[model samples]
Target: MIVYILNVIIMALGLYCLIAKRHIIKKIIGMVLIEYSMNLFLILIGYRINGLAPILLPEMNRVQFSQYGVDPLPQALVLTSIVIGLGTLALMAAYAMKLYEKYRTFDMSEIRRLRG
Candidate 1:
Protein backbone atom coordinates (compact mmCIF):
# COMPACT_ATOMS: atom_id res chain seq x y z
CA MET A 1 0.00 0.00 0.00
CA ILE A 2 2.84 2.34 0.77
CA VAL A 3 4.43 1.63 -2.58
CA TYR A 4 1.15 2.35 -4.31
CA ILE A 5 0.73 5.61 -2.44
CA LEU A 6 4.24 6.67 -3.30
CA ASN A 7 3.69 5.84 -6.96
CA VAL A 8 0.55 7.94 -6.97
CA ILE A 9 2.31 10.82 -5.29
CA ILE A 10 5.15 10.71 -7.77
CA MET A 11 2.68 10.65 -10.62
CA ALA A 12 0.83 13.60 -9.17
CA LEU A 13 4.03 15.57 -8.79
CA GLY A 14 5.00 14.87 -12.37
CA LEU A 15 1.59 15.91 -13.58
CA TYR A 16 1.74 19.08 -11.57
CA CYS A 17 5.14 19.94 -12.97
CA LEU A 18 3.97 19.27 -16.49
CA ILE A 19 0.85 21.34 -16.13
CA ALA A 20 2.04 24.15 -13.89
CA LYS A 21 5.66 24.69 -14.80
CA ARG A 22 6.37 27.35 -17.39
CA HIS A 23 9.92 26.35 -18.40
CA ILE A 24 10.47 23.78 -21.15
CA ILE A 25 13.36 22.23 -19.18
CA LYS A 26 11.11 21.84 -16.18
CA LYS A 27 8.53 20.13 -18.34
CA ILE A 28 11.21 17.76 -19.57
CA ILE A 29 12.22 16.99 -16.02
CA GLY A 30 8.58 16.31 -15.21
CA MET A 31 8.34 13.92 -18.14
CA VAL A 32 11.43 12.09 -16.90
CA LEU A 33 9.94 11.84 -13.45
CA ILE A 34 6.74 10.44 -14.90
CA GLU A 35 8.70 7.83 -16.81
CA TYR A 36 10.64 6.85 -13.69
CA SER A 37 7.44 6.53 -11.71
CA MET A 38 5.99 4.18 -14.30
CA ASN A 39 9.15 2.08 -14.33
CA LEU A 40 9.21 1.86 -10.57
CA PHE A 41 5.55 0.87 -10.52
CA LEU A 42 6.20 -1.90 -12.99
CA ILE A 43 9.13 -3.21 -10.98
CA LEU A 44 7.07 -3.15 -7.82
CA ILE A 45 4.34 -5.16 -9.49
CA GLY A 46 6.79 -7.87 -10.57
CA TYR A 47 8.31 -8.17 -7.10
CA ARG A 48 7.71 -11.47 -5.34
CA ILE A 49 8.19 -12.70 -1.82
CA ASN A 50 11.39 -14.75 -1.44
CA GLY A 51 11.83 -14.96 -5.14
CA LEU A 52 15.04 -16.58 -6.41
CA ALA A 53 17.16 -15.79 -9.42
CA PRO A 54 15.84 -16.96 -12.76
CA ILE A 55 18.92 -18.72 -13.95
CA LEU A 56 19.25 -21.98 -15.85
CA LEU A 57 22.11 -24.38 -15.94
CA PRO A 58 22.82 -27.24 -18.26
CA GLU A 59 23.15 -29.67 -15.36
CA MET A 60 20.01 -28.46 -13.64
CA ASN A 61 16.89 -30.58 -13.71
CA ARG A 62 13.23 -29.68 -13.76
CA VAL A 63 12.58 -31.36 -10.42
CA GLN A 64 13.55 -28.29 -8.41
CA PHE A 65 12.52 -25.72 -10.97
CA SER A 66 10.21 -23.92 -8.61
CA GLN A 67 12.84 -23.20 -5.99
CA TYR A 68 15.17 -21.18 -8.20
CA GLY A 69 13.24 -18.90 -10.47
CA VAL A 70 12.59 -15.23 -11.05
CA ASP A 71 10.71 -13.14 -13.55
CA PRO A 72 12.93 -11.93 -16.38
CA LEU A 73 10.24 -10.37 -18.51
CA PRO A 74 9.87 -7.34 -16.31
CA GLN A 75 13.61 -6.83 -16.19
CA ALA A 76 13.81 -6.93 -19.96
CA LEU A 77 10.90 -4.55 -20.27
CA VAL A 78 12.48 -2.15 -17.78
CA LEU A 79 15.75 -2.18 -19.68
CA THR A 80 13.95 -1.39 -22.91
CA SER A 81 11.95 1.34 -21.27
CA ILE A 82 15.14 2.88 -19.87
CA VAL A 83 16.74 2.89 -23.30
CA ILE A 84 13.66 4.52 -24.78
CA GLY A 85 13.58 7.10 -22.01
CA LEU A 86 17.25 7.91 -22.58
CA GLY A 87 16.57 8.50 -26.27
CA THR A 88 13.56 10.66 -25.49
CA LEU A 89 15.48 12.68 -22.92
CA ALA A 90 18.31 13.24 -25.35
CA LEU A 91 15.91 14.46 -27.98
CA MET A 92 14.08 16.69 -25.55
CA ALA A 93 17.33 18.22 -24.32
CA ALA A 94 18.42 18.89 -27.87
CA TYR A 95 15.13 20.51 -28.68
CA ALA A 96 15.24 22.61 -25.54
CA MET A 97 18.70 23.87 -26.46
CA LYS A 98 17.52 24.76 -29.94
CA LEU A 99 14.49 26.54 -28.55
CA TYR A 100 16.66 28.49 -26.13
CA GLU A 101 19.04 29.49 -28.86
CA LYS A 102 16.21 30.74 -31.03
CA TYR A 103 14.23 32.55 -28.35
CA ARG A 104 17.13 33.59 -26.08
CA THR A 105 15.02 32.68 -23.07
CA PHE A 106 13.78 29.64 -21.22
CA ASP A 107 10.45 31.07 -20.17
CA MET A 108 7.77 29.18 -22.11
CA SER A 109 5.40 32.10 -22.38
CA GLU A 110 8.09 34.44 -23.68
CA ILE A 111 9.17 31.92 -26.28
CA ARG A 112 5.78 31.61 -27.88
CA ARG A 113 5.98 32.21 -31.63
CA LEU A 114 2.80 30.49 -32.78
CA ARG A 115 0.13 32.47 -30.95
CA GLY A 116 -2.47 31.70 -33.56
Candidate 2:
Protein backbone atom coordinates (compact mmCIF):
# COMPACT_ATOMS: atom_id res chain seq x y z
CA MET A 1 0.00 0.00 0.00
CA ILE A 2 2.78 2.40 0.94
CA VAL A 3 4.67 1.56 -2.18
CA TYR A 4 1.59 2.22 -4.25
CA ILE A 5 1.21 5.61 -2.66
CA LEU A 6 4.82 6.45 -3.32
CA ASN A 7 4.47 5.43 -6.93
CA VAL A 8 1.45 7.64 -7.32
CA ILE A 9 3.33 10.54 -5.76
CA ILE A 10 6.27 10.01 -8.05
CA MET A 11 3.99 10.02 -11.07
CA ALA A 12 2.23 13.14 -9.85
CA LEU A 13 5.52 14.95 -9.39
CA GLY A 14 6.53 14.11 -12.94
CA LEU A 15 3.21 15.32 -14.27
CA TYR A 16 3.50 18.56 -12.33
CA CYS A 17 6.98 19.08 -13.69
CA LEU A 18 5.74 18.59 -17.22
CA ILE A 19 2.74 20.85 -16.83
CA ALA A 20 4.17 23.65 -14.72
CA LYS A 21 7.77 23.97 -15.73
CA ARG A 22 8.60 26.28 -18.60
CA HIS A 23 12.21 25.32 -19.36
CA ILE A 24 12.91 22.76 -22.04
CA ILE A 25 15.50 21.14 -19.81
CA LYS A 26 12.94 20.91 -17.04
CA LYS A 27 10.54 19.14 -19.37
CA ILE A 28 13.28 16.65 -20.19
CA ILE A 29 13.89 16.12 -16.51
CA GLY A 30 10.17 15.55 -16.06
CA MET A 31 10.32 12.92 -18.77
CA VAL A 32 13.17 11.21 -16.96
CA LEU A 33 11.19 11.31 -13.74
CA ILE A 34 8.21 9.71 -15.43
CA GLU A 35 10.38 6.96 -16.86
CA TYR A 36 11.96 6.31 -13.49
CA SER A 37 8.60 6.20 -11.77
CA MET A 38 7.30 3.66 -14.25
CA ASN A 39 10.35 1.49 -13.73
CA LEU A 40 9.95 1.69 -9.99
CA PHE A 41 6.29 0.77 -10.23
CA LEU A 42 7.14 -2.27 -12.30
CA ILE A 43 9.75 -3.34 -9.78
CA LEU A 44 7.32 -2.92 -6.94
CA ILE A 45 4.84 -5.12 -8.72
CA GLY A 46 7.34 -7.98 -8.69
CA TYR A 47 8.42 -7.57 -5.07
CA ARG A 48 7.61 -10.19 -2.45
CA ILE A 49 7.91 -9.70 1.26
CA ASN A 50 11.19 -11.13 2.54
CA GLY A 51 11.87 -12.58 -0.87
CA LEU A 52 15.08 -14.48 -1.67
CA ALA A 53 17.08 -14.43 -4.87
CA PRO A 54 16.02 -17.15 -7.30
CA ILE A 55 19.27 -19.07 -7.41
CA LEU A 56 19.03 -22.84 -7.39
CA LEU A 57 21.59 -24.63 -5.30
CA PRO A 58 22.07 -28.06 -3.70
CA GLU A 59 20.75 -26.88 -0.33
CA MET A 60 17.58 -25.35 -1.67
CA ASN A 61 14.21 -27.03 -1.25
CA ARG A 62 11.87 -26.98 -4.24
CA VAL A 63 8.78 -25.76 -2.36
CA GLN A 64 10.51 -22.96 -0.48
CA PHE A 65 12.38 -22.03 -3.62
CA SER A 66 9.22 -21.51 -5.55
CA GLN A 67 7.53 -19.64 -2.71
CA TYR A 68 10.31 -17.24 -1.75
CA GLY A 69 12.10 -16.59 -4.97
CA VAL A 70 12.19 -13.12 -6.42
CA ASP A 71 10.74 -12.55 -9.88
CA PRO A 72 13.44 -12.13 -12.49
CA LEU A 73 11.32 -10.62 -15.23
CA PRO A 74 10.88 -7.24 -13.60
CA GLN A 75 14.58 -7.03 -12.87
CA ALA A 76 15.31 -7.60 -16.52
CA LEU A 77 12.69 -5.07 -17.53
CA VAL A 78 14.07 -2.49 -15.12
CA LEU A 79 17.57 -2.95 -16.50
CA THR A 80 16.30 -2.35 -20.01
CA SER A 81 14.33 0.65 -18.83
CA ILE A 82 17.40 2.15 -17.18
CA VAL A 83 19.52 1.72 -20.28
CA ILE A 84 16.87 3.30 -22.47
CA GLY A 85 16.42 6.11 -19.98
CA LEU A 86 20.13 6.82 -20.03
CA GLY A 87 20.16 7.04 -23.79
CA THR A 88 17.12 9.31 -23.75
CA LEU A 89 18.56 11.56 -21.07
CA ALA A 90 21.77 11.97 -23.00
CA LEU A 91 19.91 12.92 -26.13
CA MET A 92 17.72 15.37 -24.23
CA ALA A 93 20.74 17.03 -22.62
CA ALA A 94 22.45 17.41 -25.96
CA TYR A 95 19.31 18.93 -27.43
CA ALA A 96 18.99 21.28 -24.47
CA MET A 97 22.56 22.43 -24.94
CA LYS A 98 21.91 23.22 -28.57
CA LEU A 99 18.78 25.10 -27.61
CA TYR A 100 20.71 27.08 -25.05
CA GLU A 101 23.34 27.95 -27.60
CA LYS A 102 20.77 29.22 -30.01
CA TYR A 103 18.45 31.01 -27.62
CA ARG A 104 20.75 31.79 -24.68
CA THR A 105 17.96 30.87 -22.30
CA PHE A 106 16.39 27.77 -20.84
CA ASP A 107 12.90 29.20 -20.69
CA MET A 108 10.70 27.59 -23.35
CA SER A 109 8.48 30.63 -23.76
CA GLU A 110 11.41 32.88 -24.53
CA ILE A 111 12.92 30.47 -27.07
CA ARG A 112 9.99 30.45 -29.46
CA ARG A 113 11.35 31.47 -32.84
CA LEU A 114 9.39 29.06 -35.05
CA ARG A 115 5.98 29.99 -33.85
CA GLY A 116 3.28 30.00 -36.56
Candidate 3:
Protein backbone atom coordinates (compact mmCIF):
# COMPACT_ATOMS: atom_id res chain seq x y z
CA MET A 1 0.00 0.00 0.00
CA ILE A 2 2.55 2.53 1.17
CA VAL A 3 5.05 1.26 -1.39
CA TYR A 4 2.62 1.82 -4.20
CA ILE A 5 1.96 5.35 -2.99
CA LEU A 6 5.67 6.06 -2.87
CA ASN A 7 6.04 4.70 -6.39
CA VAL A 8 3.29 6.99 -7.61
CA ILE A 9 4.91 9.95 -5.90
CA ILE A 10 8.24 9.17 -7.57
CA MET A 11 6.52 8.96 -10.93
CA ALA A 12 4.78 12.27 -10.38
CA LEU A 13 8.03 13.93 -9.41
CA GLY A 14 9.63 12.60 -12.55
CA LEU A 15 6.78 13.93 -14.67
CA TYR A 16 7.11 17.32 -13.00
CA CYS A 17 10.80 17.41 -13.75
CA LEU A 18 10.18 16.50 -17.35
CA ILE A 19 7.50 19.12 -17.87
CA ALA A 20 8.73 21.94 -15.64
CA LYS A 21 12.51 21.83 -16.01
CA ARG A 22 14.09 23.70 -18.87
CA HIS A 23 17.44 21.95 -18.93
CA ILE A 24 17.91 19.06 -21.33
CA ILE A 25 19.94 17.05 -18.83
CA LYS A 26 17.28 17.49 -16.18
CA LYS A 27 14.67 16.31 -18.62
CA ILE A 28 16.78 13.28 -19.38
CA ILE A 29 17.10 12.54 -15.68
CA GLY A 30 13.36 12.89 -15.31
CA MET A 31 12.77 10.40 -18.09
CA VAL A 32 15.05 7.96 -16.33
CA LEU A 33 13.25 8.43 -13.02
CA ILE A 34 9.92 7.72 -14.66
CA GLU A 35 11.27 4.59 -16.25
CA TYR A 36 12.75 3.36 -12.98
CA SER A 37 9.54 4.05 -11.06
CA MET A 38 7.49 2.15 -13.60
CA ASN A 39 9.85 -0.77 -13.42
CA LEU A 40 9.59 -0.72 -9.66
CA PHE A 41 5.82 -0.72 -9.86
CA LEU A 42 5.76 -3.68 -12.18
CA ILE A 43 8.07 -5.62 -9.89
CA LEU A 44 5.90 -4.79 -6.92
CA ILE A 45 2.83 -6.06 -8.71
CA GLY A 46 4.41 -9.50 -9.09
CA TYR A 47 5.82 -9.79 -5.60
CA ARG A 48 4.42 -12.33 -3.13
CA ILE A 49 5.22 -12.60 0.55
CA ASN A 50 7.43 -15.63 1.26
CA GLY A 51 7.28 -16.49 -2.41
CA LEU A 52 9.66 -19.02 -3.85
CA ALA A 53 11.52 -18.70 -7.13
CA PRO A 54 9.54 -19.61 -10.23
CA ILE A 55 11.47 -22.81 -10.72
CA LEU A 56 9.83 -26.21 -10.49
CA LEU A 57 11.63 -28.78 -8.42
CA PRO A 58 10.94 -32.50 -8.74
CA GLU A 59 9.60 -32.69 -5.21
CA MET A 60 7.17 -29.77 -5.62
CA ASN A 61 3.73 -30.59 -7.03
CA ARG A 62 2.04 -28.40 -9.60
CA VAL A 63 -0.46 -26.95 -7.15
CA GLN A 64 2.18 -26.10 -4.59
CA PHE A 65 4.39 -24.50 -7.21
CA SER A 66 1.51 -22.48 -8.53
CA GLN A 67 0.65 -21.20 -5.07
CA TYR A 68 4.16 -20.31 -3.98
CA GLY A 69 6.06 -19.35 -7.06
CA VAL A 70 6.66 -15.72 -7.87
CA ASP A 71 5.34 -14.61 -11.25
CA PRO A 72 7.86 -14.71 -14.04
CA LEU A 73 5.90 -12.66 -16.57
CA PRO A 74 6.37 -9.33 -14.84
CA GLN A 75 10.06 -10.02 -14.32
CA ALA A 76 10.48 -10.80 -18.01
CA LEU A 77 8.55 -7.69 -18.97
CA VAL A 78 10.73 -5.53 -16.71
CA LEU A 79 13.87 -6.96 -18.31
CA THR A 80 12.62 -6.04 -21.74
CA SER A 81 11.55 -2.61 -20.56
CA ILE A 82 15.00 -2.00 -19.10
CA VAL A 83 16.65 -2.75 -22.42
CA ILE A 84 14.28 -0.45 -24.25
CA GLY A 85 14.79 2.29 -21.69
CA LEU A 86 18.57 2.02 -22.04
CA GLY A 87 18.29 2.50 -25.80
CA THR A 88 15.98 5.47 -25.35
CA LEU A 89 18.30 7.02 -22.75
CA ALA A 90 21.27 6.63 -25.05
CA LEU A 91 19.41 8.30 -27.91
CA MET A 92 18.28 11.17 -25.73
CA ALA A 93 21.80 11.69 -24.40
CA ALA A 94 23.21 11.74 -27.91
CA TYR A 95 20.61 14.24 -29.02
CA ALA A 96 21.35 16.43 -25.98
CA MET A 97 25.07 16.33 -26.75
CA LYS A 98 24.42 17.40 -30.33
CA LEU A 99 22.22 20.22 -29.12
CA TYR A 100 24.89 21.41 -26.70
CA GLU A 101 27.53 21.29 -29.40
CA LYS A 102 25.44 23.46 -31.66
CA TYR A 103 24.11 25.95 -29.07
CA ARG A 104 26.63 25.78 -26.20
CA THR A 105 23.80 25.49 -23.70
CA PHE A 106 21.63 22.76 -22.22
CA ASP A 107 18.65 24.99 -21.54
CA MET A 108 15.78 24.07 -23.82
CA SER A 109 14.36 27.60 -23.91
CA GLU A 110 17.75 29.00 -24.88
CA ILE A 111 18.08 26.42 -27.61
CA ARG A 112 14.68 27.33 -28.95
CA ARG A 113 15.52 31.03 -28.93
CA LEU A 114 18.84 30.44 -30.68
CA ARG A 115 17.24 28.44 -33.47
CA GLY A 116 16.90 30.46 -36.61
TM per candidate comes to 0.85, 0.88, 0.90
Report the Cα lDDT for residue 21, model 1: 99
Which digits, one per residue and each the tens of the lDDT, describe model 2 over residues 1-116?
99799898988999999999998877988888899889988888998899988679998899998999889899997999899899989988998999889878999888878554
Candidate 2 wrong stretches, greater than 4 Å: none
In the range 44-72, model 1's lDDT, one tens digit per residue, is 77776786556777777766656546567
lDDT of 2 at 57: 90
lDDT of 1 at 30: 93
| C-alpha lDDT (0 to 100) for residue 4 of candidate 2 | 90
Q: Output the worst ten-in-a-row residue range by lDDT, candidate 2.
A: 107-116
Candidate with maximal lDDT: 3
Q: Write the per-residue lDDT of candidate 3 for residues 1-116, one digit (tens) a residue.
A: 99999999999999999999998999999999999999999999999999989888898889978998998999999999999999999999899899989889998878876546
**Which scores greater on TM-score, model 1 or model 3?**
3
| lDDT ranking of the models | 3, 2, 1
Report the C-alpha displacement of residue 68, candidate 1, in angstroms: 6.0
C-alpha RMSD between model 3 and the true structure: 1.6
Candidate 2: pairs in clash:
none
